[model samples]
Target: MNTAHKYMESTQMPSIVAKSLPKTWMTWAVFFFFCASVFGLAMRYFFIGDFPVLEYKNLLHAHSHIALLGWGYLLVTGILVFTFIQNPIRLNIYRKIFLLTVIANLGMMVTFPVQGYGLFSIAFSTFHLLLSYAFTYHFFKDLKNIKSNTGKTLIMLSLVWMVVSTIGLWAIAPIGSILGRLHPLYYLSVQWFLHFQLNGWFVYALLGLLLSFMEKKGYSVQISTPILIALHLSLFLTFALSVAWSNPSNYLLATNAIGVILQAFAYWIILKSAIKYLNHQTNLSKNWINHLLWIGLISLLAKAAIQAALIIPDVANIAFTIRNYVIGFIHLVMLGAITFGLGALALNQNWLVKNLISKIGWITLAFAFVSSEIILLTQGTLLWAKMGFIPQYHLLIFLASALFPLGLIFLLIAQWQASFQKHQLPKFIHKQKNQFKSKNTETMKSTVLMSLGAAMLLMVSCGGGSSENQGSYTPPSAQKEKVADPKGIGEIKNVDLGDGIDEALAQKGKAILDMKCTACYQYDGKRVVGPGFEGVTNRRRAEWIMNMITNVDVMLDEDPVAQKLFEECLTRMPNQNISLDESRQILEYFRKNDFERTGGSDAAMN
Candidate 1:
């Protein structure tokens, strides 16, 4: 009845179960991710003009670092440690390393945002890097007869790639010292690490784990040697896409393009194989853990498609030029693909509580993640086309995003709340039932701890149902209560005459924009996160501009122009929630800029 990876060796089952319960790392990981989600809320605050004390750039650093090191790093490390290493001494050492990892993350959480990469942050960051090297060593040492199974081999390769990715980071200081930070080499080196870390290491590691899981269950989900080779070849070679924007030589571009295409094909093969092997488990697909895995696979497909698109130099250039596109792509992989896989695996262990509150908690986190993504992509599209905005963007997004952290808090509570009372007697009984252990005190203690997993599985087998099958799946609130176009109080209440420029209003609007909108919008005909505002008054109607500035969320929902922006630009504008007076001033500023561009009479312009 044990739900711990079904294929766990009989000898290792006791230890695995012992380490699985309490799920200390998994619970903490979710908590840290939730903490990171708070930074996501802070981003929305910029649009709502809420929490003015927030420092946008610094918090972004905190968010990214927390999500990457705290969540991604922890999940991967935990899976690797618990899955393969059975030696008590080695397991203890792994826990110590995890402890240090936690400390480093805590240090980074404090230092990175405050100083934006000072001595303390750098030390902690480097601490993580060094620990990674240690992980690589231990992982390699612990992996036994890896070549016997494709899944384990893939994991081994992923660890190697992980170490390889850090080469760039190791070189960064020297590279920056020799050439300025702006030098292509410096940035390229950073990109190298990021590219391989996510695409090469993380992707392979997650997939390998899934493959191993299926195989352990007596399924035939093997990735043939050739396909595995092709996958790795493509993964390592796909680094070209990262540097394609530098207008590399034709030979290099072609090589990179081929690699990208190959990467897609490799994934396609893997998917087909997974489906073939998991065909029997379809009946169990209703499980929430399976749901997470499916979502992860879908996101992975999307990632492959996007990477394939970048094979076209023109497409790559456009993507490179648009910052929003970059952020969207990154998040798609991080949140949608990678985190989803990790979340499912963590939940699969059955070490954490399985109850309604935990179920709702995951749903809340998922809702927040999906909502934020839609808003971000909408904003990016709008910026690309110099068009409309998301309706009530910041406020709605903030509200949705809040649920993510809230869900995590509930999940943490669930972890602690999961009962082990019935689980206690069963540990000794389970051993007698299975006859796997003796009555030694140390052995009994460890087995009892480990049997928590088996005991819960027993409870489950004896009619304690999982939330997965509690009822039919309900749609998210957004879809459940569909709004065709939110028009109430959002209607365009005023329109400018567009007759002449008002210098005072123009100046004030400019000042306000510098303070509030500079993160995305630009004024000098050069795009930052969105299109430049130069000659802005010419392309849009006076009323449209006023509505966009003051009532954009409504406009995006109801207005065709705004929808067009969202579709074409692939980024929508966030609702700034500025006052009517401020919006009117912005309109005056736009009119004056248009006047200057058109060589209108100087009196109003001056």
Candidate 2:
């Protein structure tokens, strides 16, 4: 009996941590990601041909809401809880919070597509917001117990940004009601929420998680004072880029340029530190999770480079004007950086099931992400350069998109398989436990030295002592900045009309209106999807009309009269991808329509 008791004491069998992350929550989050991918695949198919039952706009609402709320919010919160909170009580609270969020997500998933921000969808969205507030409160309450200063600082800052982002969402209702949905203020509010949510909250949280992992891996990870100042300060300043598409003030553009430059500089410091740490890890292996993490890090670096490119006015304009570029960039961050990073961490922790199927799933997902990004960017570039559309673009992208759902399905099945694996202990251990007396002295003596040897091996394997590669790189001083000139980038500020409308231009413009403009507007001042164009040449300046057509999004955001029209129409105008010349031609078509109405004079001269 003594021997058995001593043996058990000497063995010191490891038990599950009291605050082990809830695998079930993570699994459900992945399932939501899979669902979001399916919706995305369906959207891609819509580009190839119309799906009668699927409302493209409503489906878009569903896809974005589910991807952001169902997958992003849930996964990020789970990761933060796993990394920071240790008390079982806090863990329980997080579990309950997770379930509530799940309910909100499911509600949005069902309601968004069915009613498109109707009462139910709004209710669910509001519920989710309230729940997030609760989560923020609880998380901060337990934050003091965290030992890692760098991680704690980042986590806290991320939560602050998360809360600040909601201020934008809350402003939306009032802004929309007062200034209309198409008002610059309304658009600014919406972008404010998104900018902070993606770049501020998500970015910081992931970095914090990374720092925590590095600390755990026995690496001395520290954010230098200069880099830290640049990183957090840049988050606030970089929001100017979100409103840059609206042709914001020169000061705003200058600030954004500075922010992006600072952001790039900060990332350089971080990248160097990460490389040094990685180099020092002699025990690192070619594990799939490690490979995934490397890919994620590469994507993060690429994201920094892309943001830095926005310092060019032309690049900034292209980013907003081209829908393909916008979508591609969002996916690059969401899938390439955020998803890959979190997925790698989950895999490292064995939270994601490890199996042949899961390996194939990761490979498929990686390939699909890369292939789809290439297609989207290539098409966007072609369009930007006034080159014609890519041949079979929609079809090729849809095929690539299909693999996302397939990969997720394989991963989901692997997780289910892990749940059913035999959980019995090794036969030898079981037999010894069964046979040994309660206090077996002999058994204890036999394993005592082995236990000590194992402890020593673990300490050596984990690599003790201060990291030798720490603080090797000095951060570069802030550079004297030159802001990019935003004039005539994507906005048309003036137009010089000739003495009379060109008859041939009117004829060409008539064809374009028939094909594109007619879907939304009528020449007879009858509103369809948008306000009519019957007397638009008289009501607005020729420059205004042309600018509105060529720069619909920016016009809707910045123009007061356009805001009123949007308020009355209760719908924002879509970008028709019309060029400056096409817009000038369309202006002539409006002139011709008004000439007939006025019986002789062209109101375009007004």
Candidate 3:
């Protein structure tokens, strides 16, 4: 349990089954982060700044899920399990669940980009959720044995928050169904899940690790017992500020504001503990892992400050409506705060190869992360000011994002080389028993070549590129152009229902829904990419439904309901060009579905 020796060698495989498996798992997880970055770049390239590599919407789904589920989930889980699972025999079950999580993540990575949120992706997502539930249950049962109250309490609080966040995640479909994805709840549900995930589970879990690490080092994070209680309470309560966009009651607002203030103090308490430990250390280097951590701390503070600002009614109202501001803030939290914190933990634990090339690679990634944030926040601010767009913004972001993967490639190569060196060392000593063993020339040569190749590609990718063939921004002017519905097209001003169900017509409509709507909406009250279709008839009028199907763009522009849906969902429904007859058929199908769920004989409305 002596941390310096215990953790310093964590990156090196200690045992046959226990250590090696976790090492391998972490490596793959890190690689997934690298690959997720590619998906992220593709989104920026096509959607924001450059050429169409893939559908913008699909890329967005893929990128976000992969980053959050695949990378972030795996990274944090790996670190937490390896650091705490005191019983190594328990490692087998942990490994099994980890693999399940990976499988689910891979399913999302493949299916999300291809079809966005559909059957395949949702199934995988569900699998991961269930797996997480199992993992959490077992983890809590096991870690409850930890003697220290502070560490165990923080860990327990994190799991509770994680479970709580899923409430918001699962509610999206049902709530969206009830409110047509146009109500404030649809958006607020999503924000609720994310706020808890990032701020609640992730932040607290990392802090728990810090505490665990400190205890192992024979140091304790000193804060008053009363303050500790406040910290835990405030962690859950501060979520109010994040959902200020939902415009809660004044009492809720006051409570949330107090939570935020308490949270600031909570962080200070943790920071005090961290400073005590770091000041005694002498591992500072030009490699600058601490710099990334500083970025994370600053970003966390800034996020808190922004949330505090939203307590002002005018700012809350303005921020609630602006899409760019939301996107910028999310990335700031994800990339700047969580990612940097994880990276610093990895480095501090000696979980990375510390050669010059790897050092450069890590720093390069740091640069890319920082640069992308600069562009994103700058662009978001410009949008808030009604500025048109930045020149070459997408291409610039694309290039900046590419560095992330490129850095990973270097880091991976270095690790591979390190493993090779470790393997070869015995032979090297045997071959030169009478002499000194030195750096392998051939391996160093490969490292040098790899570095050169990485450098050249980074330059080509980032250098000034053509904006014409690639593309430009979404255009500020585009927002002003309202989509007007074609007069009288697919209009359903009246309804004539002679029977309970149009059996054949309903079948055909179901087929159409299967083909076209499968990506987003579902018939049975579960959300896919869009809101579930349960009680659709209750939610919208026949005419409104027809208008939405036939004239999506027009509805998105001029229809307040449709506009609200778009604002909340953050994705526009593409026009599938339904015919007048087809629209009627779909409505009849909806009616039939409602009858089946209610278990009533087919009833016709006047």
Q: Per-candidate RMSD vs. true structure?
A: 16.3, 15.8, 15.4
Candidate 3 segments whose C-alpha is farther than 4 A from its true place: 1-14, 47-53, 176-179, 241-243, 246-255, 283-287, 318-320, 386-388, 418-606
- lDDT-wise, the better of 2 and 3 is 2
Q: What is the lDDT, from 0 to 100, of the residue 449 in candidate 1?
A: 47
Compose the digit string of candidate 2's lDDT tens values, residues 105-167.
776776566555455567778999999999999998888666756767887998999999999
**Can you write out model 1's per-residue Cα lDDT over 1-606, one digit (the tens) per residue?**
475545344435455334542376676676678778777667657656634443455577678878888888887778776667667556756765665676677767665555444445566789988888887887788786344687788788888888888899888878645643334566678778888888878888888887877777787576777887888888867777666544345565677778878889999998777766555566444687677667777788888888798777656654655554676688778877777776776677664556788888877767766777777667756654545456775577678778777988888788766532224445644554243323332553564344444434433553332223222222222223454332223445446354556787888776556444655765556443356677666666555676777776556545555554543232445444467788778777777776676654223222
TM-scores for all candidates: the values are 0.68, 0.74, 0.67
By TM-score, who's the top model here? Answer: 2
Q: Best by lDDT, which number?
A: 2
The clash numbers for all candidates, in the given order, read 16, 11, 1
Residues 512-564, candidate 3: write the lDDT tens digits. Answer: 66444543565666443466677777667667777777766556545756665
Model 1, residue 131: distance off in Å is: 1.2
Model 2 regions lying over 4 Å from their true place: 1-21, 282-285, 425-547, 550-582, 585-606
Weakest 10 consecutive residues of candidate 1 by summed lDDT = 469-478
Query: Candidate 3: global Cα-lDDT?
Result: 0.66
lDDT value, residue 60 of candidate 1: 72
